[model samples]
Target: MTTVHGSSYRFIWFGLEMVSLFIHFTCLLPLLIGTPVTRAFMPRLNGATFLGPSNALSPVNVAHSRNRGIFCMRSNEMITVEGVSVVLLAGGVGKRMKADRPKQFIELLGKPVLLHSLEIFSTLPGVNRIVIVLDKSYRQEFSFLQEEDPRIVFADPGKERQDSVFNGFSQTLPDASVVCIHDSARPLVSQSAVLASLRDGSVHGAAVLGVPMKATVKESADGEFVLRTMNRSRLWEIQTPQVIKPDILSEAFALVTEKGLEVTDDVSMVEQVGRPVKLTMGEYTNIKLTTPEDIGVAEGFLRERAEGKL
Candidate 1:
């Protein structure tokens, strides 16, 4: 647990409110003035349109949908992902990196690697709360930072990744309608991509992001030889920020606990409980940092992004 001082805490909390209010009003003002302030870039292809707003989940028809091209954002765009809580899992020891501290505490560009995802989630209009799940040992190290943001709360992680998420989910507020679980290592996940998952998940019972499979895959009986070639067209490389309705998630998790099943990702639980999980468009730039080599790659990606080359 962490303690926040009186006036300083108030300032940080109040500052967050002021900033949130400013963004909320500023983004909405465009709609009142009748201007195209932004546009949602949906799927790329015309046929298997994963990028464009696939048919919305709402029974009521949505206006301003773009066809096979660009989707612009008007000033009065009200289709936003708000009042959701994100559980960022940073419980791993990251033995692969072999750092003195865990990978989450390691410095990336200027701030800690975990801060990269935290900063992005804090600014999104759709997200109201953020929960960080840390290993029991790391709690004391992370405690002081928790007081910096009023919207943030901490959770004691479990031994498994799923356990960490389950632990974090337990701490969410009763009013949180949407629940999002993401990896702390994937600092580059875009706000638009996350919003897309939330928007689509609101319609479908659950939604997740998956990159299309471009490389050939092989399934082997053992490490000795390759078995057969997999159909890449049907495969998608799964990624995080898996968003879903709170009740649906709760039900799925309940089933998981009852059956004593082990799931690597939240979607597996949803699937086991007979819920459909839809895939929305996600950026290819989203990468998970697991090893020392990945640090160089992430730095390069950040540099290219800064230079407008990515």
Candidate 2:
């Protein structure tokens, strides 16, 4: 009996050793075979492919798992499958910007502000196409853009921001599973923030990129007097590239049409339908080109980025 017990222990130890060796082999196999490992990896989940680093996981990925329905937890970085489409909203006339053209048409860093955001999305993997929601009046000015990238297409702007998104969504291919909505005026969006928002959206049905409010808040019934002081801790200033599953966005839009509600942003549509949206942290440098003063700020940010200081 003593001999048999000793043999069993030895067998168990050998099995454990083999398991460790296999795990190590799997990790190093790409290097051993001289295959290049990309910055992103694709993981299969529930018949969908998720692109991200397979080795690391973040707590933020699991933050809404229980309460937000089905959540696919993965690393902070992720790309969707080849069916992702981006809607660049440039329909708004820059009344406040006081520019010669629309804010999006204004030049920043020697390129049009809209082009800066367009370049970012076009280069990302899994972004199959981008729909620029512009007025018919501006189409001739940007006609050369189509020659630059085959994935770009234009959609006519509607009366409101939500309408523009709806028009953009209609232009996406039938196979598109995910939709990313961004403001063309925000020319400084980083690749990291876009990826994080995409991953969060894929996992939690919807996601919005934003930064927490830095200043104390006040609520006013009238412009001159304050009604109450708002809670600064819970306040967040939202930014774009808001991402969502097409089905969820479609449902949100359906509700919007049924109720005739005017929405300021895309994620608010999900909220109206009682859906939760994950908030991904975005940089303060991703500012919208709202007024003339913002141009100087953007130029400085661009300089910092070029010098590797950002």
Candidate 3:
């Protein structure tokens, strides 16, 4: 009985050794054959397909092919997907705020209001580039912000908001696909609103953000008398992050320049060209900080967001 038990133990040990050998072979097989498989599947290397050492198939030669598929997929997807460009108009003088600093440069919480506006666009996955129109004297300040994110570019501001937007668009003319014009004073612009405008522009050529007016609007010839009461339903308070295709926007701006027309926003320029601009509903809390009172409102909004009330 002892001899029979020893023979059974030897047989079990041999079986275990064979299983270990099989597992090791299975693990090494991929390393051995990965290069041939990758070379066979990869497209020819040329100027367009050259990915250098960071290329997906490079891993086949380096024994770390785990992220190869991801690299390849991203490269292919980026080639076809058009990205949106954003133009932030930061040239306003901030006369209403009664501050020495421009409204965009004013400190909100701890950071500058303009920095917060740029951060919102910087965080978005679809935003490819950002152009900031600033006062010529503040070029140094904008340069510091550009250093923080290379995606940000600077433009010389014009006398009016329309001119500032035109200058920003001109700077981005060569590369921008869809251009989104936003006010730097409106720090509460959300990712949803930006994405919504981008998508609408992609489909319909132009779009703008606006909130339906709640108060009764009136036209008055004198301080004491109201000439007419306007329908609130037809009235909307316009906001920023207005998006349009680059070519359409360029044409519209050209028309406005030819006609010697001064408009408030890019949407008006597009409208002057007879292009229909779609409206996306914007949040009431997305207010532009025009006065000192608005700063308190912004602080309250920030506190609410911190407390999970937004």
TM-score winner: 2
For candidate 1, lDDT tens digit of each residue in 247-276?
A: 998999899889999998988899998989
TM-score of 2: 0.77
* Candidate 3 lDDT, 107-134, residue by residue in tens: 8888899988888887765566789988
Which parts of model 3 have CA positions greater than 4 angstroms off?
1-81
lDDT string for model 2 (1-310, tens) is 3456888999999999999999888778867777544412445454443343433222233121212222334554433344678999999998999988888988877988888889888877677789999999889999998999888999989988998999999998777767999999998988767767777788789999999899998999889999999998999999999999999999999999999999999999999999999988888889998889999999899889989998
Q: List runs of model 1 lying over 4 Å from the truth.
A: 1-78
Best by lDDT: 2
In order, candidate lDDTs are 0.76, 0.82, 0.75
- What's the ranking of the predictions by TM-score, best on top? 2, 1, 3
Candidate 1: worst-modelled 10 consecutive residues by lDDT: 67-76
TM-score of each: 0.75, 0.77, 0.73
Clashes of each: 11, 0, 0
